[model samples]
Every structure is written in C-alpha cells, then in structure tokens.
Target: MPPRPPQKPNRRMRGFEPASGLLRDRIRTVGEARGFAVSRLLTHWAEVVGEDLAARTRPVKVGYGKGGFGATLTLLTMGASAPMVQMELPKIREKVNACYGYNAISKVLITQTAPMGFAEGQAGFGPAPKAPPKQTDPAIRQRAEETAQVVQDGGLRAALELLAQNVLSRSANRAVTKKG
Candidate 1:
C-alpha cells in the first residue's frame, strides 16, 4: 500500500463540540419548527388581510395553548392611523373563523400593548390578538402529519403555508414531523 498524505483538518466536524451536540441538535430542530410555524401564520394573515397589511403586522407572541390543540398569535401593527385595530378587529375575526373552517376559535381578543417607544407613533385602538383556544381532534392530528410532510419535502416556505392553513382549519397546535 502506498503511503497516504496527511488529510487537512476539517472545520465542519470540529465546529460542533460533542459536549453540546444533543442540545445543539435539539435547538436547531426547534428553531426550524418555530420558523415554519411563523411563516405559515404570516401567510394566513396575508391571505386574509392583504400583503400590505400582513407585512405591516409582525407577530409579537406565539405559543401552544392548553391541550396542545391551538396556536395563539399576537401581532403588533407597525404603522397605522386612528383606531385601525378596532376597525380591523372584525375582519380579523372573520378571517380567523373562516381559516379555522368554522367558528372553532373561542376568542380573538385584542389589546393595545405595543412595545415601548412604538405607542407614541402608533395609531390603533385595540390590542393585539391573543391565542386561540385549545383544540383536540383526530382530524387535527392527520392534518399536522400532512403539513409536516409538506414542510420536510418542500423546504420551509411551502411547508409553512401548508401548516398555517391546516392549523387554522383544525385549530391545532402540534406540528407533527413525518416519520420515516
């Protein structure tokens, strides 16, 4: 056998230390999932309200509600003029209801809690939307699986849109990744 040349040290394998390997991997997974969920939610907003409105409203809070069936989103309206939130609350409610395939949403509470320094320039009466109620159903699980597959196969953006619609329709929170 011929003597082999010394291989150059690679950074890819060295960058991630074994001490935090498990934690790092878990964090990565979580980040990706959160990103997907946010994307999906934004798409839903855009479809309901217009691209312009969606762009203006940024999500400020997101979390899985009780029983892990519903996802809540609180968004802050960037720039507005005179009680825009109040005027838009009904439309938002309608859109949310329609998105969930019915009136599955128990509440669409809105509040005025803009970030510090934002309120002075902002012009809205109502608060940001609160979390939707928890939901539990076989249909929601099935949809989560389907949505997860779409995300795994089609990259982040496509999966997000799929997930957003499914979550809205089913009023569910879990994002089930495809097994195998």
Candidate 2:
C-alpha cells in the first residue's frame, strides 16, 4: 500500500489569546440576549455618559422597537438621583447617540430604587470620605524628592515628589505582596 500523507488539522492551535478576545463572542451573545445590542453602551457607560452621571446611574438594558429602531435606554438610579437623571434625559440621549455614532437612543428612562436598594444595589452619589494620609517611608520620600529636584518651581517640585513617592510606594507594595 502507498504511504498516506499526514492529514492536516481543520483549525490551527493558537497560543496565549487574550481573555477579552476569547470572551468577545460569548459576551456579545449574552449581551444581545439581555437586550444590549451594542455592548459598548454597557461596558463604556462612564465614557458614553459623563463621570458624574455614570457614578450616580447605571444602565440596565436597552429596549428596541419591533423593527429594532429607536432604542429606549433604561437606567437605574437611587431615588434621590431620579429627579436629576430625569432632567438630564435629553442630554443623556444625545450623549448615548453620540457614542453609537448615530441617533440610536431616542428615549432615556430612569428607574428609581430605595437608598439601600433591592435587586440592584444603590449606586453611590455621595463623595467618599477621604482616607487618612499614610506615613511615607523615609528612604522613598528622600528618593522622590531627589528625582523631583530638576523641576524649577518649588510648588511643582513638591507635587512631583509627592506623586513619585505615591507611585513608588504602590509598586513596592505590589512587589512585597508578590514575594510573600
């Protein structure tokens, strides 16, 4: 019998695919099932709407007409923020349309929940309390100051030094955590 050539596989194996790349199709399927045709609206809510609005409100779902035209975006907000969200409906619709690169959202509806919340937890609108300042390591503090010495302005130098110290401290923490 003549030797048979090795059969080629139908699909080639890929190495190290990104989580997002692999999950894209599944995410789309799930999102579409949940009435989110354009998942970016949900993923990039903060970008579509301003930070202030984003923090106070959360996109629940998008309702499309039978023909899939003139989508109505439903948002969940705390009872207190409902009035503010109501006033910004026009603005929100415009911004959402802008994100979709068309007049996709014709209406924006706000659903209010209790402060403590029920199914969906309350999205905090109040500013978080500031954390007490931590004492910086003296060596890190000195190194950051030395690095910022090139800056001419004293105020700018001080700010830069503080920023450097914060960055180094975070990186140091990560290293220590990884080692431990």
Candidate 3:
C-alpha cells in the first residue's frame, strides 16, 4: 500500500485574535464620526478627570468646527454642579487635551441637567447585599450587645451590634474551616 501525502494547513481558519483588535477599526470609525479619536476618553473619564468631577459630570460629545480649526467638548452636569463645572472648564479642557496628546478640544460647553436627566438610560449596579443575619453563639451575641451599649443613639447601637455579630461569626467560621 502507498503512503498518503501530508495535508496542507487551512488558511481560512485563523486562531484566536483579541476582541479589541478585531473590533479596532469599527470602534475607531464610530469614535471619529463623533469627533473623537478613541473611546478611551469616554471609558476612562474618571481617570482623565478626577473622581469628584467625574461623579458629577458626563462627557456627551465633541463637535468640530469648520476646517477642523476649533473643536468643542460638551459635558452634561447636574444643575447644582453646572456652575462649579463651568468654572473648571479650563482645567477640564487641559486634562482632556492631554489625554488626546494635543490641544484637540478648543472649548468646553456645559449643559445643566436635572439629577435624573443625564442618568436616565444608564444602568447601575444595585446596592450591595446586607451582611447575613445568621445567629452566632449566645456568648458572642451577648458580648456584641454589651459592647454596643455605650453607643448614645439607639440606631447606632443596633448597627454596631449587628456589625460586631457579623464579624465574630465570619471569623469563627473561617477558623472552623481552617481546622477541619
């Protein structure tokens, strides 16, 4: 019997490429259409502007003027914070331009909005879970209650007691698991 010839490698089936690389052109096209070089400015806005400013403001879009001479950046901010952000326009423009490695933004436009206005379509991660209320040993509960007795406010005392009980229970469970 004759031996078979070796098979040629498949040219059409290329192995894994990172999603970022695969979508780079499309993302860049969309960003350019919006007068921005990259989405990194929008995505890492908190890093571009300080957390305090980022929490209060949202970058909406960039508009380029005729001949691409001057570009304006529009930001949406809560009504109460609009004045404050308006005053910081120069600083924000500098920071944003730095992100783009040039003086791309020539002006900052502030649009005041209600608290719920700008956040209308955005989804937020729900509130964190409350610590489990699993009952701990009687001794631990008694100790926590006694320690919280000095708290002047009834609400504060109750909160402290719950926190102490949760901590003690979690530590006890960890110790038991380690031993077993």
Candidate 4:
C-alpha cells in the first residue's frame, strides 16, 4: 500500500469567508448556524455523556459530505470506544438539528481523532490512555532520600560508601559466614 501523506497543523478560523453582497450574508449565516450546532452539541454531549468525556470530545471540522445531503461532524476524540459513541452521537445529532431549526442538517457524522498525536507523533487516535500514578511508599521514599544524602556528600564519597557498605560488606559477610 502507498504511504499516507504527512498531516498538517490545524489553524483557527478567523472570520467569515470572503463573499460578495447577498452571498456574504448567507456565508455569515451559515457560519453562525454551524457555530450554534457546535455549541449546542457540546452542551448536550456534556449532559448525555459527561463533562470529562465532553472535554475530551471536540468538533474539529464540520461540513457537507459527498453530495451535501448530510453534515459530517469531525470530532477529535482521545480514544475509539464504539459503545460510548453510540450513546453520545444520537443526542448530538438531535441537538445539531434543533440548533439549525431542524432544516439544514440531514445527518451528523462523527469522526474520532487525536489532533496532537496526529500532528506530533503522526498517529490518528481516539485518546491517549490515562497514565498510572507514580509509586509513593515510605520505603521507596526513604531509599531515595538516603541516596540523595549520600550524593550530597560528593559523588566519589557516595560511590566509595556504596562499594564498601554494600558490595564489600556482602562479600566479607559471606566469607565470614562460610568460614564459621
């Protein structure tokens, strides 16, 4: 198979596209309509799914697909969970339709994505998995503190101390025990 093209950085839409006279008003109206759909979708999504999931989901791009009978909603999601999408999408679609007066939007398509990973790591993703918390036990903490204190005494001194106390002591202990 052929290699995929390199992904480009996403840029913000500054304002309405340039159009003349009557067309300009139509353009602005369309932009506003789409914006309304996005806003309402976000709100509805938060209510339906959850704020945490909603925050992870965003409308990256929205436009007419193929012949323009349907609206394509490109969502940048952190991960692909089919059941989660199934639960959230219908509500989002209904909200979009309501926002547009239930006229212009024929359908809503959800495309999951990971913009950062796509741009930085060149990977299309749903979402990055949450990392586990670091270890924080007292024993580990004490060991780290002891090492830090020894290093503070100077690298050579620390190294000698470790060698004599750990390596050499273990060897001498073994020898003494074996002899006894």
| Candidate 2: segments with Cα more than 4 A from true spot | 1-15, 120-127, 130-180
Q: What TM-score does candidate 1 reach?
A: 0.33
Candidate 3 is scored at a TM of: 0.53
Please report how far candidate 4 places residue 79 from its true position, in Å: 2.4
TM-score of each model, in listed order: 0.33, 0.58, 0.53, 0.41
lDDT of 3 by residue, 47-148 (tens): 999988888787778998888867899887767778888889999999999998899999999877665553542422234469986657998899899989
Off by over 4 Å in 4: 1-53, 65-68, 80-83, 115-144, 152-180
Q: How many clashing pairs per prediction, in order?
A: 3, 0, 0, 5
- Residue 131 in candidate 3 has what lDDT? 95
lDDT of each: 0.52, 0.86, 0.82, 0.56
Position 134, candidate 3: lDDT:
62
Query: Any runs in candidate 3 off by more than 4 Å, and if so which?
Result: 1-26, 118-180
- Which 10 consecutive residues of model 3 have the lowest summed lDDT? 118-127
Instruction: State candidate 2's TM-score.
Output: 0.58
Which structure among the candidates has the greatest lDDT? 2
Global Cα RMSD, each model: 24.4, 15.9, 13.4, 15.1
User: Model 1 misses residue 172 by how many Å?
Assistant: 64
lDDT (Cα) of model 3:
0.82
lDDT by residue for model 2 (1-180), tens: 999999986976688778887788988887788788788887788998989899889888888999888989889888788898899999999998888889988888888876567645465556668999999999999999999999999999999999999999999999999999
Superior by TM-score: candidate 1 or candidate 2: 2
